[model samples]
Target: MLPRNTVDTTVLPPGERFGMWLDLVARTSAPLRVESAHAADFAARADFTDLGAIQLVEYRYPSLDATRTRKLIRQSDPELYVLALTTSGIGTSSQDGRRSEILAGEFTFYDASRPHDVCHHANEPGRTRATSIITLIPHAALPLPPKRMAALYGGRMSGSEGLGALLAQFLIQVTGHPEQYHAVDAGRLGTVGLDLATTLLGRNLVAEDAVPTEVRRRALVTQVQAYVHRHLGDVTLAPRTVADAHHISLRTLHRLFEAENTTVAAYIRDLRLARCRRDLADPALRAQPVQVIAARWGFGDKAHFSRAFRAAYGMSPQACRDGAAVTARDVNDLASRVNSARAD
Candidate 1:
């Protein structure tokens, strides 16, 4: 197993910090060159080996000028493509006549060989917490036109929705549980990586229709489901809005859902009910009125919410909430009994 590698520049001078960064880059590939206005005070860690086709790295740094950062990237690895998820701080990058500002909770991709700049500003001095998962993959592996990738290079892609959400969650999980993964899992993750990259590229290019029929169909359904779940609070949300978001006809949207043995309306209701069920079981909301919780999850009529809840769980809404409390206590008691038995 590969042990995690971590480095904190706060403990080292500028020269030593740059030297450590160089050593890290060299460990994976050729030697890297470094340059900066004032040397970077940064920290980074890697938890996996480079034996896999792709490598993941987590890095953080304070605010810096765009020109200097681009220069460093170019000198370090001119042929690699870098996809960065900015967790904090604000930054902007420009390429191919397109310029975009990346704020927290967004992602941007760039190529090291291209001359691009990124400027970062912290909300407060010495308080920047920019967590990025940088994936290094060969240019040929992308399987998309260079122009299409460049079009998306500096733009903010939504990481909290659909495939982006799945991708972000996977990266976060692996960052914490790198040891649980093996070489086979890494290869599978690479396939997912390509799917995500392709999806993002298709969105940027306005050429989703150009993707293979099955892949496009699956991606569209995923995007539609995400949209529905996000807008459940809006009473106006319906099949029309879902179709409008993806620029498809309502009839076609229904056809897509039919493939999964569902209609859009049924799917939305099921999702809303699931959300309400979760809220009813939450201990923190025990004091809140059940009607308020129902409305919060898009159930406008209290009577209707109760009927639906009972139909789904075979118990009234209030009874279901009470049952959750009993279940929690029973689980606690069972755990105690198991511990006592183990001790005996």
Candidate 2:
């Protein structure tokens, strides 16, 4: 789980709100700036938070002047990936040595790590309504190469098709039903985000091969692994069962695992043993018997589980559990020292 903090500044003076926004960008490392035609009445509102591996920012800009906006972007050099969807008004943006005019019903993406500028001009008074959803994710999280992503920057990618369309729709849904998402759902959303962004950006660059076969294979494997881990307690967790859940034939499923050099049963056993090892190390679980923890991770036979755990971690399950408790204490002690030092 990750901490979530929200700041809504529609109530503040435009100048004060802008200042507060600058402070937020500084703290979050999201380099962005805004200017309004009626600097006094113009409102800027943002909902920003970190969801585990991804940072999400949703913003609305109302009635802004184009020239003043140019100055703001020149100043904030935050190196991050940004996706901006315009819900209303007309604007023009330039980044990565490319410039494009943005109209209503259009969405554009750019890289903020480099310098970029966007100018918004409303058609009439109180007419501008632009909403943008920006994400700050680690470069490594994207399966595609940076050069491929750069090619797609400042260009209009199809958010109206396949996974991109679904993602765009999902974002709209989340905005409408923010309450529907819980802490756990945010992580899942982040994963979907990775897939959507990567897929769209890849389509834009014509770099379909940028995504390696193994990486795609691993992604599927990870999904299956997570599903198996979650349902390990069920007695019927087996290869055929996993295939059915994913809507793939057993032959296709076997082909997917071929690159991993392991069968589905072996993979499940390995993951179950790994989870058991982790549980055993937890001091909170120390009171529980080794057999109980083994059963929890779906090890029906205690002796077999013990042998596997020992082979994997080079220690008996009980010794590993005891060692984990000691390690947890050391970690807690170090954390306390760091906190004390910061306080000083």
Candidate 3:
């Protein structure tokens, strides 16, 4: 799991919330001049998770003015563009002389390398506080000219619809389960994020062609992979079924998989085999039988599944289930049968 930096104002005395938060944020993200409504009313908490190139910070706090100054930029390392998603709060931000009020389910992109100010206050004094998630994206991820890209900054993108909704869902997954993803997964996630953001901004700029072709292809391929992974337990998940579900032809689906150095059938089979191998190693699954595990991953024929398993893993299913060691995060088929059998 991804480690996080968490700060709760309730831990310290009410008077220390302002200073302590400043210190914590300075270490977790870009250094800034922070001002709360008043010294005594400052009550807040923040959780920050650093994902490879991106950072996800969740906050619930009273109104405050957070200023990104030139001096802070010179002092900080690896400056970024902060994309703020306000989920349950009201916020107004200003950058490059642009200002906008962000409501619930809205996002604002502000450059940490430039002078900017985010002023948020509880509309009802001590009765309310703005809550938001800040995703820090690198400048390199966005591939548009400054003037063109400036339109996305300090404005609200409806997080409730279209590509914005998809991106919001992705952000939630990354922040909610960072540990479930690996290094390569992180890079893929980051790439998809850039592609989606670029696509969103490009549409608004009336320059859809500005997005990189490879990036778009990767995004589509990632979507296909996710579909296949989610339906792995379905014995009917074939290439044709996949293509039809995606509204693409079988040939096109094969073409997409070709770029990944594998075919659609091979990909699904490999994933299932890996899962079976993992379950074979699970001591908790020791009482399970071999044939059940094979079928669980959509292997219809016991002999066929055994031969395939041995060819890929150099062992029979029974041997693997006996004492072999394997590493896998996902399992299917036989494990389901095992559970069913135990329940019966």
Candidate 4:
């Protein structure tokens, strides 16, 4: 599992919770004057993942307002690019004399060297807390020029599609599933995240030519990955089609995956099998036929899919699903017994 530091303020006293939370944020990223309605009885948690040159933090808390004043900046500055995405809330930020509204599934970029105000609100009433993820990158780590990058300060970047979406998803995945990766994978994932950010910024500024060739190539590969994911349901999603869709030669496509040490077919097949495996484990989909589930992920033949799934997972699809069902039943039974004991 990747290294992570988690701080949950709920363990502290009501009065001390907010203070501890404030101190955690200041130490992790930068100092800010944060005020929350729930501060009197605050409950919040943060998961911090250090990715060498970059840092990713996921914050879950009630609605709050925070400000990084010029005075605060003068007192302490990290000289970092803070890109925050609202995963389950509505937010607005002001910087560079501009105020940008950040709806759910959107992000805002700002510099820690300057003053900014951010307000995050729960998307609807009765929600316990709003959620967001922040990616902190050193100013020098990004390949884009400072002057051009400045144009994006306090601007909304849609996470609904394109490079912005890719970056947002990358942050969520890296922070959410650190256990799936080794510590050595952190720096590489950070680089990919930074490359996606540069691509998005450069494309928005109409300065794609300004981005380095290597970064551009990596960004193209990232885009290709996204494209393949979106088209995984299409049985015709082959290397030739993928290359043509990207307007690149088949040989170039092969070369790109070569860097990842996999062929295009293997990549696509692995993804499909993984998806199939996930669906099979889903209790709600228990009634769904194995053949139907297989076909849903571009597998037209059950025998071929079974063989591939066995090769990948070392178990037949039916056996995998059966194991999941048994596990789920055991968990539910345990919960019921615990509840009964509590009632007694």
Scored by TM-score, the top model is 4
- The residue-by-residue lDDT of candidate 4 on 212-288, one tens digit each, is 98898898899899899999999999999999998999999998888888999999999999999999999999999
What lDDT does model 3 reach? Answer: 0.77
Choose 2 or 4, whichever is better by TM-score: 4
- Give per-residue CA lDDT, model 3, range 168-271, as digits (tens): 77777777677787655765566677666666666666776776777666666776777788888778889999999888899989988888999999999999
Model 4 spans > 4 angstroms off:
229-233, 247-255, 261-263, 269-344
Assess each prediction's global lDDT (C-alpha) against the native.
Answer: 0.68, 0.68, 0.77, 0.89
Best of the two (1, 2) by TM-score: 1
For model 2, name the residue pairs that clash: 79-113, 80-113
- Number of clashing pairs per prediction, in order: 1, 2, 7, 0
Give the TM-score comparing model 1 with the true structure, all chains together.
0.64
> Candidate 1: misplaced stretches above 4 Å?
1-16, 29-31, 37-56, 63-80, 85-196, 203-210, 258-261, 331-344
Off by over 4 Å in 2: 1-4, 13-15, 25-27, 64-79, 121-128, 214-344
Which stretches in model 3 have alpha-carbon errors above 4 Å?
Answer: 1-11, 23-43, 47-52, 62-79, 87-106, 112-131, 158-166, 178-196, 203-206, 286-296, 299-304, 324-344
lDDT at 124, model 2: 48
